[model samples]
Target: MDFQESKTKENLARSFAAECQEGARYQFMAKMAQQQGYQYMSMLIRTLAHNEMAHAQQFFNKIVELGGNQTQNIEITAGYPFKSGELLDVLKQEAENEHMSAESIYPKFADIARDEGFEDVANLFDMVSKVERTHERTLKKLHENLSCNCLYKCNDEHAFKCDECGTIIMNKCAPKTCPLCKMGQGYYRIDFSIN
Candidate 1:
């Protein structure tokens, strides 16, 4: 199938639409985190939002490379308004979203791209699907820890820095939030690594 053909074009446009939706979703989550006093978490989520934007740009660039149409792009529909709830509720929702993307959405897109001979796009889909799966696992772990009330049970010495107020705290785990700035524990960092 040619890149500009209907099936290929629809997939590219839909992929771009999905990327845009994911980007917006992350941004909304980041905003919510920031409002809830999770500064570091907000920052990390914002970084993720930026990454999603980059992915959308890549999809868009590919569509443009194949001479995408504005009308067709506008016609492409994608997005899901996430549910708002308590902390555990939010975590569960995110985990479910990640699972859907990893197990259903991306894999299907990857397969279609492969069949259409768009190896590069297929690779992108596969890579993103793997990342989504990892995210699902991490979210589930967080949910489990919170559910069991063991989020801050540690014997060895541990420390965390508040991303909002820059307060240094030494404890078994991060405080429920920064005592000084009231930033959520999500804003607390135990060990930040750079690659």
Candidate 2:
């Protein structure tokens, strides 16, 4: 089968567009978080946005390298979420979106690529699916923490790091503001390592 005419090629194009859209959406979410006085949360969302962009880059590279699609339009039709609401609700919905991509969307793409004899593209989809799973977990945990008003709280003695000034504080809950940077508690982050 010709690589340029394969379904895998189409999937790659779709994946690239989807990842780009997700990155932009997350940036919008980050801006909202920052405006709402959750600086560290905004930074975290920006990190996710960056990850999505990286995924987009990989997909674009695949289209160029395997499909020679640099000048040609790939002509893909796909649906994307347009969400707005409270920041917490948005995060929760984003988590669900990640779950759909990880468990349903990307896996199906990978299977199709494998059946089409595009093993490398299948592997790429598999790898990105795993990352999306992690993204889902991270977003869900974030939604839970923020909803419970424990974005920086723990039941046991723990450490919190200020996103600014690199200040480390050991406490059950973050201070109202960083002692050094004077930034609000929103600048503090607790390890959510959803791995």
lDDT of 2 by residue, 79-143 (tens): 88887798998999999999999999999999999999989999999999999999999899889
Residue 76 miss distance in model 1 (angstroms): 3.5
> For model 1, how does the per-residue alpha-carbon lDDT over 1-195 read when each residue is reduced to its tens digit?
667664556666776776677778767777876786656556765776676677778777877776645435335566665587776787788789879988998899888888888888888888878877877886687678668865554556566677667787777788885689885677676643311
* Candidate 2 wrongly placed segments (more than 4 Å): 69-71, 191-195
RMSD of each: 3.8, 2.3
lDDT of each: 0.71, 0.89
TM-score of 1: 0.75
In model 2, what is the error at residue 171, expressed in angstroms? Answer: 1.6
TM-score for all models, in order of appearance = 0.75, 0.93
Q: Each candidate: how many clashes?
A: 1, 0
Candidate 1: worst-modelled 10 consecutive residues by lDDT: 68-77
> Which lDDT value does model 2 have at 38?
88
